[model samples]
Target: MIAVSLLEEYGGIIKNYKSGDFIFEEGNRPLHYYQIISGEVKMNNYNDEGKEFIQGIFYKNQCFGEPPLFIDQMYPANAVAVIDSEIIIITKDKFLDLLKNNSEISLKIIKNLSQRLYYKSVMAAEISSQDPEHRVLRLIDYSIEQLNFKKEEAGFLINFTRQQIGDLTGLRVETVIRAIKSLEKKGDLKIINRKVYR
Candidate 1:
């Protein structure tokens, strides 16, 4: 498997961590590329008010630490562990070497960056829409179509707290709650044990 190959090639440098661990902090120079072998990683940024805004979430086998790969710089956002995790870290130099030697990986990196950009645009456009309830649905649609998430894991892995969702979707938390209630009322979605499903 590709996973096995990546591990065999880069496993020695990985670090194991627990929930609440800070994988990498904002403003920190990123010297490595992070590959999540298991568990979840939250990409967030904090406002001056000290409120954290969730930007992206990675599930098992997903990866981040990309801006470093491109511009040789620090990340503007924080990468945090939302669950116990194992991460394989490939140094920036090593990753650059790999990309230079392997065109396939370089192409994959380009594709990933393109996808990230698209997601950014979609989120911005959806949040800018005037309809708060539609904003919530747009957020859900963006997650399902863009992130390849199922209806069930929408609220969890997209994993925004109500406040975070409001911040991201440009809605008030109370409005988000009402919208979710509306969805439930229409039998279009269901939440049970903190999970949402259609």
Candidate 2:
């Protein structure tokens, strides 16, 4: 990960956003590199029916929207703050220069991107062919693997809301609810104090 001090030295500015603030909108030209200093962000899209689909969620010290910065493409989804968040924003030109000048950082970025690609591929398969419960399980497992979720004494605590889980897995919230209940009965997860753990 790139250090915040290093980013500041390279012309990055720290900005704060309120919950539900749009960091960037779909189809906008990518102009800045964004890295979270604290709090959560989600990239999402709305369908014609206004149903939301979450592309991904990122937390502290994570970078978002980098592919567009590298490829010069319009953003494919909207990035929004899931909570009040602080982010470091650097001009795309400066970010690219920073990457170019740091081979180790560039390789780390490549590895991170590759992991994201792998997640997308697995989710695509799950959404296309799996049952609702299977899809939900796969999504939860992916989160556990990719989000650095730790196993508590009870189990691995899932940080996402049911609606967020539905958005991520292409299921209706009702379906997600049913699937989670089924998963619980099967001993795959638990509802502890109204929160889910797996």
> What do the candidate models score in CA lDDT, each in turn?
0.73, 0.94
Q: Give per-residue CA lDDT, model 1, range 1-198, as digits (tens).
A: 025365447532778889999998888988887888888888888778876677887777777868665786778888889889988887777777777877887787788788878878977887666577677766776666655664344343444556756766656689988887788788765767665554
For every candidate, C-alpha RMSD to the true structure in Å: 3.2, 0.8
Estimate candidate 2's alpha-carbon lDDT, on a 0 to 1 scale: 0.94
Provide backbone clash counts, one per model: 1, 0
Among residues 3 or more apart in sequence or in different chains, the pairs in candidate 2 whose N, CA or C atoms overlap within 3 Å are: none
